[model samples]
Target: MKKIGIFLCLIFLWSNINASAITYPKITSQGAVLMDINNGKILFQKNGHGRYAPASTTKVMTALLALEKCKLDDNVIVGKNPPLEDGSKIFLTKGEVLTVDQLLYALLLHSANDAALALAEHISGSKEEFAHLMNERANQLGCKDTNFLNPNGLYESKHYTSAYDLAQIASNAMKSSKFREIVSTLSFDIAPTNNHPEIRHLHNENKLLYSQKYKYPNADGIKTGYTIKAKHTYIGSATRNGKTLVVVLLSGVKGYYKDA
Candidate 1:
């Protein structure tokens, strides 16, 4: 009876630990963080303060900066680069004029490196100048561990941030109506323009929008990231009973190990 009781106690403890860790993975990425949106308390953290390449997730700040510094009605000429990007893209032609709003949509949804560069250029006249703003703004916002070496987050030696820092920045970005609008949109309705359009369709890559298999009902707008090293990083959010939570997973690979 003693042995059986001990085994039962062990099982109960193990189950509790698993439950806590499920919502709190210790180091899924180089760093990971989960936060409560209501009061901004950190729910869980794993290497959340360690620096790692943020990859395309860098654009959340890029878009945030653009929305603050540039006017949507402003016409921006795509500077022969965004459409020529080698990675994920929506393909904007060189010299094509798009409103700052349109270019922003391109940057946010497509994660187009060129669109980021173009938006940077449009906002600060050059990517280098815009990068300066990114770092400064991050500091201003109290992201002590964050740095921005490029507007597009293309993995530079000097560019790095932790999942905690990412969450902080995301928490701020979430306050913006424009940012929320863009990320929540599963598909954007882009009208045709002279460059080419019969209503170009853009889809949000976030798979969670498709009725989460894990029973999260209020899941909504967020971002995903990966690189050769980063391996399927994701930032997710959802609302439950009027409470919101932000979950960050980094350095994650499927079928290898769960965050818990």
Candidate 2:
């Protein structure tokens, strides 16, 4: 009986130690998910299927459709409406010509609202039509809780996505070699164009890729977003030891990167 009691105590202690070892940090974001990119396994989540405004993370869908429908070298002539877009921009003016490749770099690296509008207009003839395409693609990807009202992720009452849905969209976008290359780039230059004479140097806004304070090991391609309504949102990807993970956070108050 004494030996049996000692064995039972040892077993209980071992179980306690293992339970303590497997704990996960408290995630503060309202919506969050960590997924294995390769297998679509959801490793962790907090309200992963809860809907929230996605902000500029909508560009992942925009960029993916652009790559699918247009050639990189195809030229897109800026329209009157793109320059009129609200929020961040490269200030593309009417009749300014840039290839699909250049616009993608602007769209992803800089999160340029104007660039997203231009690509949408170029690919689908108008933002409304392009939004239709965005929804269609999201549906096909098995995302049941996403709706995109604009390619640029500007605030709209109905435009929203869950953390899981956004992760699915981002994982699909990362499959493209060009998409991967463009998002991973730290900075790029759009040479002097008909609309502007001086070279426009654009830097990536994703702090995880460049900012020392927020940088994560093995971090690479992905996107970030914010709006008064959305607050803060991010989709971050990193790879280590042959496995890649995609982390999504939406509607966080601040410091979402640290939570990631």
Q: Which candidate number maximizes lDDT?
A: 2
Could you tell me which residue pairs clash in candidate 1? 28-250, 29-250, 29-251, 82-114
Best by TM-score: 2
Candidate 1 lDDT by residue in tens digits, 101-128: 8777777776778878888888887778
User: Given candidate 1, what's the lDDT at residue 58?
Assistant: 86
lDDT of 2 at 48: 93
**lDDT of residue 40 for candidate 1:** 85
**TM-score for all models, in order of appearance:** 0.83, 0.91
Q: Estimate, for each residue in 50-144, the C-alpha lDDT of model 2 and write its tens digit.
A: 99999999999999999999999999999999999888899999999999999999999889999999999999999999999999999999999
Candidate 2: segments with Cα more than 4 A from true spot: 1-21
For residue 78, model 2's alpha carbon misses the true position, in angstroms, by 0.7
